[model samples]
Every structure is written in C-alpha cells, then in structure tokens.
Target: MIERTVKYKKPSPKPEKNRDVRLPRLYKSLYDQIINNHYKNALKTVNKLQRLDTDNEELIKTRIFILLQLDQFSHASSLIQSSSQPFAYEHAYTNYRLKNEHLASQSISPDSDDRKWKILSAQLLYRQGDYKSAIDLYESLMSDLSPDTDEYTDLETNLKASKECLDFHRHGYLQAMDELNVPPLDVLENNPAPFPDNYKPPAIDTSSVTVSSATTETPSKLLKQKEKRRAAMHSKHANKNMQIDPERWLPMKERSYYRKPRQQMSINHKRR
Candidate 1:
C-alpha cells in the first residue's frame, strides 16, 4: 500500500463578500442597542462594528441618524452628505435648502430628483413665468396624497396658491376691461351749448328815467313822516334776525325792566 501523502488541505477562507454580508446583522443589533438608549454600549458596539465593517451603509446611516437625534445637525449634515447610498434626509435637506412650495425661511435648494426636490431645486413655476408647469406639478403632487397629505411639500401648496393667485389676477384684468368698455360719464367733450337764431332778450324801456344832481323841492309833512317811518322800519330789519321764543325769557319783572321805553324830550321855549 503506497502511503499516499494525505496532505490535509484547509478549506479556502470564506470570501470578503460573505464576511461583509454578516456585518449588517451585527450593525442592526448595535443600532437597536443605541435605540434603546444604550448610548455607551451602542458607542462601544459601533466602534467595534466600524473596525469590523469599515464601510457598511447601514452603519453609516444609523450613525448619522443618531448624531442628528442628538441635535448635532452640522455633523449629521456632514455625515449624511457624504453617505455612499442616497439618503432621503439628504434629499429632504436639499429641498430644505432650495425651498419647497412652503417657502420656509430656513430651507435651502437641494440637488434635483425625479419630480420632487422642491426644497432643493424646484422653483415656483409661475415665478419663472411657467404657470402651466406649476399647475401640472401641483396637480400631480395632489394625486399622491391618499395617506401622507400632511407631509405635502411647501412647493405643492405654493403651486396651488399660485394657481389661485393667477385666477385673481385674471379676474382683475377682466374687471378692468369691463370698466373700459362701459360708456363714459359724459361723452360730449367741449361742445358749446346751443343758442337758437331767433332768441332775443326783451328790450328795456327807460324813456322816462332821468338822473338828477339836486332835489327839486322839500317833502311835504306827511311824506316826511312816511319817509321817517320807512327809515325806522329799515333800522329794525338791519340787525341779525333770529326767531325769538317766549320760553327764552329770564322772568316777567326782568323782561319788563329790560323793555322800559326811552324818556321823551321836553322842549322849553324862552319867554324873552
């Protein structure tokens, strides 16, 4: 019997892919640990995991999400921005930058995507003079709201507002045209009033009227008395006239005293 050298062959080492495939399960366990508020353990596990699976996507995503939960936005932003797989938050954040339909002050424009990315890249179509596009975009977005309507982007609602705004502007224009088409208040401009050819004012008859420089004679006694009466009547009317009421009187004795007549003049002739 030839003693065939039974060289014990060691099975080839398992492939890197097979080793990498195991990392996610352990990574997820570590994630759960952190999720349970096991910060120290989670950190320790993540450190061990990083050494074990240097570039695992789940590990990275979890790390960044944890950092974000810790309110470390800047660091989270950095990590997420540098992720290998595309992150929804990155997309959401890009939208945050570019502004969604909502126009929140804090949002910025992000990179573009397929039909979404308002926060990052989509602009108000109407603002860009693309009303039809804006309307279409809004309508399309509305159709997707069976479950998550509350999560509608600022962009979608803005598009709706833009549509309403467009209608309002159109209404204003129509009103303006209607006003223009209506007849003017006064159509006749600068037209002189008509004067008939036969129109004539009555002729004045002043043949007996004469202007005089001096009085011809002194008035008779009765005429002078009438003239004095007329003068007195005119003086009575010359004061600012107002209605007098009996109720306005202070008292009977006071009124009688106020109404006392003036004393009559007594003339004395000299008996020389």
Candidate 2:
C-alpha cells in the first residue's frame, strides 16, 4: 500500500438561493408588460422565461392569459390541456374564452379559497348570459378583495359590463332612450334638426389639447397596427351603412334573420 489514505475529494458548496439561474430582470419586464396591457410583448417575454423557468406556475398562468388577450384561443386551449398542473382559475378562464362553457364549469374548484377563481366564475356566468347570477357573485366576491388591487378593479369593470349587458337584454333600444332622456339618432336624423335654424353646436376648445412630441412623431409599429385595425373597422362600418336602405326599414317579422335593427344602425353611426 504505497499510500493507504488516498486524497479525499471535497464536495462543492451549493450555490446561494438568490444566485439561482433565473432571469429576474426579464421576469420583471414580463410583469411590467402585463400590467401595461401589452399582451403581445408579454407573450414574447413569457417564451423567454419558459426557456429558463419552465416549471413556474405563475408564468404558465400569465402565458395563458396573454394568449387569451391576443385572441389566440386555440393556443390557450392547447396550453391548458398540455400543462402538467394548470391553475383552476386559469384553466376555467381559458376554457370559458374558448367557448367551452361545460368544460369551464367542470374545471372550477368549488372549494377554492382563491378569490381569482370566484372572479373567473362570475366572468363565465356573464359570458353565459346569466348576468343576474354574475352580478350577485361579483357583489359577494367584492367584500373579499381589496379595492386598491388590480383584481378588484377588473371585478368592478366586469360588474359594470354585466349590468350593461343585462340592461341591453332586458330593455330594447327604445326603452333605453326613454330612460336616458336622450333622443334616438334615427328619429333625430329622420325628423327636422332639434335646434333652431342657424343654431350651431358650440365649438370645442382645442387650445387645452396640446400634441406631445411623441404624438407628432411617427407612431410605433404596434400603434400603427392598432390604427390600421380602427381604419378597417371604420371603412367596413361605413360600407355597411351605405348599403342600408334607410327609406325602407325591414319588416319586424323579417328583422331577426334579414335586417339589422335601426338601433344598431344608430349605434354604428355614432361609432363613426
């Protein structure tokens, strides 16, 4: 035995917890994009993070939400199905957005302690046209969420939309006009001008509105795309209106299948 005691190999020390191989800056950027409603950019960041932290539950949830926001429902649905362990709320939400209501209801955890699941349930109810149920659920859930949180803000917004949808479903456009004490545009356009001859609407003051350098400069690619969408929508709407035979309103019996309602026409006109 030339050397009975061989040199022992020392084990390497574990890296510090804070020194984990995660792109914290990129994660923060993803969060910032989500908060700013930049879902397209957020989706891109999610792919980057997945390369590093594939098992992060929050990232998976966020990626599903971003996909939904981007109207990539097929991708969202596939993601939900493929995820090893999807969050109940996110799974329910993605299913709801994909119009799989039955599946969405099944995914919801009745015993879930998370307030976000309740919010998703309410949202599903709203989408199902159960506005009253959604409203009640929202009211109940409101007590659990802090008013300062973004979740609460979103809940409030959904509540408002549910109420609006309920009202629209219950009351016809004519009834809404009566309730609001506003003249319907078709009536106004068909009849004489409400104001006296030579009466002009007051000119809006443009002095208070100053165009910033950013506004004057060429728009960003994203903004330009948005503008293009708006332009296309405006053009399509204009073409539809031009094709409408204002002189002959479609018969009530045929309206459901063949004609767009006068109220819709008025609404579209106002959108211009």
Question: Best candidate, lDDT-wise?
Answer: 2
Q: Per-prediction count of colliding residue pairs?
A: 18, 0
lDDT of 1 by residue, 49-146 (tens): 77787866677776765665565556666666677676764535533434343542234333445554552233445555566666776666666665
Q: After superposition, how far is residue 250 of candidate 2 from its true place, in Å?
A: 62
List candidate 2 stretches off by more than 4 Å. 1-38, 52-62, 143-272
Which run of 10 residues does model 2 get worst, by summed lDDT? 235-244
RMSD of each: 30.9, 31.1
Best by TM-score: 2
Alpha-carbon shift of residue 101 in model 2 (angstroms): 1.4
Residue-level lDDT tens digits of model 2 in 70-112: 8888888788789887456666776787789999999887788
**Where does candidate 1 stray beyond 4 Å?**
1-48, 65-73, 80-92, 95-132, 147-272
Give Cα distance to truth, residue 200, candidate 1, Å: 56
Instruction: Give each model's whole-structure lDDT.
Output: 0.61, 0.81
- TM-score of every prediction relative to native: 0.31, 0.42
Candidate 1: C-alpha lDDT: 0.61
